[model samples]
Target chain A: DTAVSQTPKYLVTQMGNDKSIKCEQNLGHDTMYWYKQDSKKFLKIMFSYNNKELIINETVPNRFSPKSPDKAHLNLHINSLELGDSAVYFCASSPRTSGRAQETQYFGPGTRLLVL
Target chain B: DQQVKQNSPSLSVQEGRISILNCDYTNSMFDYFLWYKKYPAEGPTFLISISSIKDKNEDGRFTVFLNKSAKHLSLHIVPSQPGDSAVYFCAAPCGGNKLTFGGGTRVLVKP
Candidate 1:
């Protein structure tokens, strides 16, 4: 069984199209996160949610938004996608009991998106 | 500005040898360091981590060394095997629950 999973492992869309990526974790974690690994292979944190509460938002653009319906799932939606948005997006989860900032995070297989 | 940096984009090591990957950070507030290993199509897996209070932490064949004064940390893999070849990322918690990651370093173990 996968500890963390994402739907539509591959997504291809035209520029300006709207798209979404879904994530779920079965590890009973209270914190979830979204990361984008660009062509430079730098995995940058995009957003973080703890128990359905938004806790961290990086310098990402307004076109990207993250939603956490519950502790087990966090979804990312993009509007007016651009060529720069083409990258691998990953979902991660971690227990908040340990210091939320320093605890180990478990990541899901990335969703590779291609924007034409 | 990039807080965490992995200058080496790639590395090559022979089997049964030692592989050392280096990382540097500009943020002094980071008290914890971590390394994540990622295969071609899979997500990153937590490999090892070292707390600021300690200089070193070891698990199995992996060891993480932290030098607070130098603002540097490294991952050492002993007796490197083919299975150990993957992209390794250096990371640290930024302000809250989020982490700042360095550009990954790809390691290839030659048999």
Candidate 2:
């Protein structure tokens, strides 16, 4: 079974259009995350939710918002997307444990977004 | 600033040879390190990991080495096969529930 999955494997939209990418994990993990991989293949964490609570919010702009309905799902919504929004968005989840640093994350296939 | 840095952008190796990928970190607070393999059109998959307390960790043909004093880490794949060609990312726990990833090194295993 796919442990982590994301919808809309590819998305192409015009500038100023809004889009949303959904993510779900069946690993029963308590923490979910949204990451952005740029053209340079640099992966950066955008947001993280622990037990449906916002825990990590990076330097991402307000145009991007992440919502976690429960421990199993985390979705990302982009408002008025721009050309700079073109990149691959990845969703990941990790089990909550006492050793937070030692936790391993599982990532979904990712959503490729293109804004013309 | 990029906390984790993989200076090598690409590496090519012959099949059945050892492929070494290196990563460096500027943050001393990072206690755990991980290596992930990613292919085109797919997300990264966890390959191996090593803790700050240990210098090395091995799993099958994959091994990760950590140098706390130098704040460096390396991933070695022995007897690399063509199927092992992919982008390798080195990551560290940035704090709380976040991870700081490197720029990634693309490995090409030549048959």
TM-score (0 to 1) of chain B, per candidate? Answer: 0.98, 0.99
Model 2 agreement with the true structure over A1-116: per-residue lDDT tens digits: 89999999999999999899999999899999999999888999999999999999989999999999999999999999999999999999999878643368999999999999
Which portions of model 1 miss their true places by more than 4 Å? A100-102
* lDDT (Cα, 0-100) at A78 in candidate 1: 99
Q: Which portions of model 2 show Cα errors greater than 4 Å?
A: A100-102
B20-39, model 2: which lDDT tens digit per residue? 99999999988899899999
- Assess each model's interface with DockQ, reporting 2 decimals per model: 0.84, 0.83
DockQ top scorer: 1
TM-scores for candidates 1 onward, in order: 0.96, 0.97
TM-score of chain B taken alone, candidate 1 = 0.98
Put down candidate 1 lDDT per residue, A16-90, tens digits, no spaces.
Answer: 999999999999989899999999888988999999999989889999999998899999999999999999999
lDDT of 2 at B34: 89
